[model samples]
Target: MPSKSPAQAALEKADKKANSSSGWFSSSSSKYEEAGDLYQQAANLFKMEKLFREAGDAHAREAECREKCQESNEAAQAWWNAAKAYKRGHPDLAIQALSQTITHLTKAGRFRQAADREKEIGQIYLQELNDLRKACESYERAGEWYAQEDAQATANACFKDAADLHADLEEYPQAIARYEQVADGSLSSALTKYSVKEYWLRACLCALAMGDPITAKRNLSKYSSLDTTFSSTREAKFINIITDAIEAGDMETLTAAVYEYDQVMKLDNWKTNILLKIKKGIQEEPTII
Candidate 1:
């Protein structure tokens, strides 16, 4: 064989480097392995050149390649750690890590793997932590993620639970907001009608208890409109007796008011509100007529 020229040798070396770089872009099993090796080589090159950003990108690329080739758990952990490091006191970092974990695990169908992490995040913000808003956000994300996986019922339940939690915290507006969403999204018409009627009646009774006859009358009117059972002559007569007692300011009329309120509460359309208000008034020593 003829001796090779220096230019030929240099060209051969350049070709070899090109082949290694091209290997990273290959998807075949053998090529994937070669890609891994090439990624490592690129990382070393970046590190040697003191190009930290490029080095990080190279490392990330290697990790991504490994993930694409069926090393999901390793990839998730790697991205999670990187996200944590990058987050270092920055909320954006935490969000990125959490989002990446969800994305990777969901794509890989590793629901169980992501579930604990999601729950961990929720607890960190909700329970042991004092960030109710953040906790709500986490729950919302979990619900959304589950929904995307075709778990509609589970997602609905989760959102409902979060709404309840918000309610329990005396976050009435938030509770009402979430409840409205739940009501709009999944509640059956029958249930929605029942809930509206029930709550309106409760409001009416509360107004009556507070001697706010105007509000009470308005709510009662609304309740009656929604529920035919409340429009009965018997219920109307009972409501009339209370109205007359209120106008009379006659404590002597309380006995009749109590009897009428109790009867109204027993009616099918009448919710538990009338009974609650009567009970509350009886406790307050000035029975609201």
Candidate 2:
């Protein structure tokens, strides 16, 4: 018979700790502590052997033991450890552990930590899982927490990320709404004053793409009336040209104006794509009146 490796030995020990953790602790609080400590030891051993799955399980066991021993904070820490252990090696288990961490942290009133987890989950959802919608929700939740903390820049950034993801998924209404929110907020900030027109332009473009003439006209009017700086700018003039063409159902005029803008600004692929979408929307419309 072949001899068991050190990893096997560690796993056996971890299994024993997990199996016997449920013993009746009739007034002896030390039992839970002993089991929790043993589980943590096994978890370290598993990690040392690169058995991340086993390590995650052991760390989770440690958390459960700590919880039963009334060590709430330690339990939360152990759960966090489990999440980290599972993060790289196990996708499903990692999210589950993160959810557990969020629950415990929220119950403990650690809003900041909870927000961090929300942001982390958002990143994982987008990068690892490729679930864009869930990622948007997670980022939006983080934005809300940041807003509560009065971190306006951070909050707006998170909101913008969520909006971008929504737009990438072609959720135009959501993108438009988020863009409008950002534009409205930017108008009130002296530091962000110069960015106001750009934000409104993005919102207007989204409206046009979605074939919402009312919204496009409203945003165009908003741009013209925003401030002296905006009303007199080249971007404001471009909006007027595009809006007039769309309102008149004149595709030729719209095309010419877009070409002019592109020639001057050298539109990036994304901007060109948005403009193409606007043109398509115009072609599909029966009449703007």
Candidate 3:
């Protein structure tokens, strides 16, 4: 074979080098496009599958492309749906969705818009469902959100409702503590009166049921002082006999009185007080007529 001229060889070498470079560039660009297409396909499939979590992951990969294509609305909608799906059986997810919604709306300067969603979640946990603890937690979250928005009364009311439910469960210490909070805070008179009265009555009933006469008497005195009509004619009559027997210092009479009262009252307190009084009297006097 005849050797080529220097210029011809050099031109040929340059052409070959250009072609190789072009080929490499084309291959790299094709691979990048393929990756982009795969990501889009995965996102579409995730949407169809209602797999929000996977969709979110896939969307994160193409976030720049999504922003350029005005696909943020679609991403937002997907996140919202996924949050809802988790909410039915997952309280934590519901809370996350609510938080995200608040964040997004607040960034957009539409705080009130986010508030509606938050209130919906609060009502679901508080009223429609009977999960009082969860409901109260939700209310507290709402109250914080409302307070941030300067809605004081709404926040206070939420706290009040939470406290009332705690009281209903007979958590006396917690109930009393919450009641004190309301009394000290800017709570309304109507609510204050209702809660105080209800808590007092419940405490009294609980002390009575627990067979604590001292506590019962204290509660009774408070109740009677508050409402003069708070009278149990039957109980008073039954107790009168034991009081008389104690004052008379007669064991036989006390025993007979308690037995008679038991026949009429048939309650532990009446029997207990009668026996206690009779034992005390008998101990004080060794001789009985």
**Reference-based TM-score of each model:** 0.37, 0.79, 0.37
Which lDDT value does model 2 have at 259?
A: 86
Per-residue lDDT for 97-172 in model 1, tens only? 5666677887888775566456556755654456777777677767676667666556655665566455444454
Per-model CA lDDT versus the true structure: 0.55, 0.79, 0.50
lDDT of 2 by residue, 1-289 (tens): 9998665676566557546645464443566677788788888888888888988998898888788788877888888888888886586787788788888887888877777878888888888899999999999998888778777777777787787787777788898788777777777888977776766777777777787768787767766775657767777788778888888888889889988988887877656788888888777767635
Backbone clash pairs for candidate 2 read none
Which sequence of candidate numbers ranks them by lDDT, best first?
2, 1, 3
lDDT of 3 by residue, 1-289 (tens): 9996443343344334323433544654343333334444565566566665554444343332333344444334434544555554555565565555555556666544565566656666665456767666666666566667777666656666655555455454554455444433442454444344433433443343333445545555655565444444444433344444544555577578657756875645523642454365445665555
Evaluated at residue 181, the lDDT of candidate 1 is 57
Q: Provide the lowest-lDDT 10-residue window in model 2.
A: 20-29
Best by TM-score: 2
Clash totals, every prediction: 0, 0, 0
Candidate No. with top lDDT: 2
